[model samples]
Target: MIKKLLELSNLETTISLRQKELLELEEKIEEKKRLLKQLSRKVRKYEEYNVAEKEAAVTVAVEAEPDSEKKVGEIARTDLVRLLESGRVPQSVIESLKDKRYSKDTFDLNFPMLREVTDMGKVDELKKDQ
Candidate 1:
């Protein structure tokens, strides 16, 4: 009877150790799953950026212009490029908009104050007004 009791106690200890190990392994698996989700989101963001770059390349080729003259849209983009350095906007959002061309007619309609100041050639006046 004494020998049987010792055997039973040893068996119980072995089972408890295995249970602890199993719990640890499950925790590790959950941590790995979280990491995988984060990595996947990053991959998707980069994929979208790649697609935008390809589209921009095609647009630049189609809208080639002489170096001496600048288009109205080009002028707006040049002025707006300051957003990239302003730190108020996200870098990713600014990068997407930096290469985009804005129509002067659209700008005038949407932002009349901006259009008026830009047209009047008063950079300081616009800044002071804003």
Candidate 2:
């Protein structure tokens, strides 16, 4: 009887461990899905910008609605966040921006399309994810 009880307890423990691992795997899967969606959106934005490479030169055109009041040449902050998360921008560039002392000219020079970022909260979230 004691041996049977011990075996049952062992089985219960195994079940619990497996459940925990399953939950972890689910979370990882969800994260991957989110990343995939973000990448898809980035690709679409690139298409809208009309970025194309021809004859070893790149051309970019930003199209906006006639009634839109957005600045003539500026990329959205969320787009920048996605770009940073996508690993297209080198880790060194992100590291350099970590310091708040960087001048606007330097920032503009590095990220020409990004005129300004109002919601730094997303950047913080991106750092936390990394």
Candidate 3:
């Protein structure tokens, strides 16, 4: 009985020491995380300051120009440049447009009728077979 009691006491002591060490390790881990967060905050602050400095230097050298160079319909230039950038121009219409010698009126659209349809027909045919 005495030998068993002595073994249990030794085991209890070892367990208590291990638990104390584990608690100390957890506290150290939390402290390290706090230090890391502080360091990251400092790094972010310096990055923001560096960016602000560069922006200040760049803005000093930059000058504003008149915007009269841009056309009223900027999307036309965007779309045309996008199409040209893709390098897939293979249509006869585009080739004819590239000819550049045609009269300006050749591109004019002819329209005399304007109609708007808003009705959705039911599940029955409205027109008979011809």
Candidate 4:
């Protein structure tokens, strides 16, 4: 019957649309998982350099590897990035850097900053689930 054929056509079309949507949702879930992993790594890095408040006034010993060549009195920008991300750096310290705020006395070191750059141009279409 023509009525029966129409019903079959409509049902197939609806199923195809839903299948496409399911694929898109799956892709988003995967993307979110990747982002979570990146954030967790950042958090772990933050925790590594984090200091407890009670230990604030305490002086800690510094031990550099005999073969290491890192400077004793300087941190690179990436190191600065860690400090900034740690959230424990006093606002005063951040403020004091003002003159060095992109200001001179500002010895340039590569600091890590928390920034996520999403390029929208590379988005891909999710293929429909079979």
* Cα-lDDT of candidate 1: 0.58
TM-score-superior candidate, 3 or 4: 3
lDDT of each: 0.58, 0.54, 0.53, 0.52
Q: Over all chains combined, what TM-score does candidate 2 have?
A: 0.39
**lDDT tens digits, residue span 56-127, model 4:** 411211121324565634443444555566776555344544433332333342331122226645333211
Off by over 4 Å in 2: 51-130
**Cα lDDT of model 1 by residue, 1-130, tens digit:** 9999999999999999999999999999999999999999999999888778656643553354446677756744763444334554444333433332322232233223232334556665654522
Model 4, 129: alpha-carbon shift in Å?
69
- The lDDT, on a scale of 0 to 1, for candidate 3 is 0.53
Write candidate 2's Cα lDDT for 1-108 as tens digits.
Answer: 999999999999999999999999999999999999999999998765543322112111122133445553344444455555666554434554554444234443
Model 3, residue 96: what's the lDDT? 41
- Model 3 off-target regions past 4 Å? 63-130
In TM-score terms, candidate 4 sits at 0.42
**Top lDDT model:** 1
Clashing pairs in 2: none
Q: Sort the predicted structures by lDDT, highest score first.
A: 1, 2, 3, 4
